[model samples]
Every structure is written in structure tokens, then in C-alpha cells.
Target: MAQPHDAPTAAELVAAVREFLERDVLGSLEGRTRFHGLVAVNVLGMVERELDLGAAQDQAHAARLAELGFADDAELAAAIREGWLDGRYEELKSALLDATRDKLAVANPSYRS
Candidate 1:
């Protein structure tokens, strides 16, 4: 919902555009154009999802990274690649799985099925 006079929120605007593309534009395209339109629709859908879920997911991701004793993804990856987390495999795997699930929840919820 919008905080100012119930005006359309950014997420609502993005959803509207995505829906318009899906309903009106995609069907009118041909070959490469249609393919590109489909990609555009998918991208818009992803954007809508991100707008809705990004904040909470970002917090969860940050917590996971902190739990792994890292400052960020780069640090976490470096630790893993350098074998620093070798002995913490299960812990690392659980945190990674949680992060992946959060990502999929926004990117493609059906993928987990």
C-alpha cells in the first residue's frame, strides 16, 4: 500500500507494467521479438518480486553472512574457497540453503517445487 494518499506504489506500478506486457504486448510479437518480449515480462516479474521481498531477504542474507562470521558475500566466498570453512560444512550448508531459498522465493518460487 502507498503511504501517501494511497497513490500507486512502485511495486504496484511495476506489476501493472509486467501485466500489461504479458497480456497485450507478448501476444502481438513474432519470433525474436516475442522471445525478447517474454524476457522483458520475466524481468519485470522479477523486479516486482524484488520490490516486494528485497528488504526482508536482504536482512536474512545479512544475518546468514554474519552467522558465518563474514562481512559479506565476497568474504564468505573467500573463506569457503580457501578451505577456512572446511570443518563447518554442515553449518555452512544450512546457511547457504536458507539464503538460496530466500533468493528462489523472489526469483522463482516455483523452482523449489
Candidate 2:
């Protein structure tokens, strides 16, 4: 096995591959192939964004969940489904919206606009 070095992080490696695909492979393709290549590049971009933002988003999600008095999504969902959190609908909605925006920021920042 090869030893791991810290210089090129996972995000960096993904970005390098994404750049290569966009610069070299994408320009040579046409029609459906080019479309698929674009999709692949977009997926790689999402991965890179996730690598950069996932940790902070996760922490924010957990904090939101905790603020709502739940341990995890399942618990929160159960409470909502059971109508136990009906009185806190606004609070829940705010938390959910924040979480969704965080996800959108990583998946497609344009969506937030």
C-alpha cells in the first residue's frame, strides 16, 4: 500500500480530477457523451463541496437537532409525526430550513439564490 501524504487532501485530489475532466475530456466529447461527462463533472464538484462543507454542516445540523430536544433526525421525525412537536412548528421549520440551506450550499449554491 502507498503511504498517505498530507499535501494533496481528498478535496484537492477530487478538484484536480474534476479540472482534468473539464479541461481535457469535456472538450473532446460531443452530444450525449459530453452531457454525461458534464454530469460526472458536476458530481465531482458536489463531492468537493461536500468535502469542504460537510463537517461544519453536520455540526450545525446536530446543534439544531439538539436545540429541538432531539438526539437525531429519526427522533425529531417521530415527534413531528406523533404531533408531539406541533406546538413548536415554527422552531422546527426554522431548523429544517437552515439544514436544507446548508445542504443546498454544498449541493448547489445557486439553488439558495
Against the reference, the lDDT scores of all candidates come to 0.89, 0.92
Which residue pairs overlap in candidate 1's backbone?
Answer: none
Residue 38 in candidate 1 has what lDDT?
91
Tens digits of lDDT, candidate 1, 1-113: 74664658888888899899989988889999999999988888888888888999999889989988998999999998899999999999999999889888878888975
lDDT of 2 by residue, 44-77 (tens): 9999999888889999999999999999999999
The TM-score between candidate 1 and the true structure equals 0.89
Q: Which residue pairs clash in candidate 2? A: none
lDDT of 2: 0.92
Candidate of highest lDDT:
2
TM-score of each: 0.89, 0.92
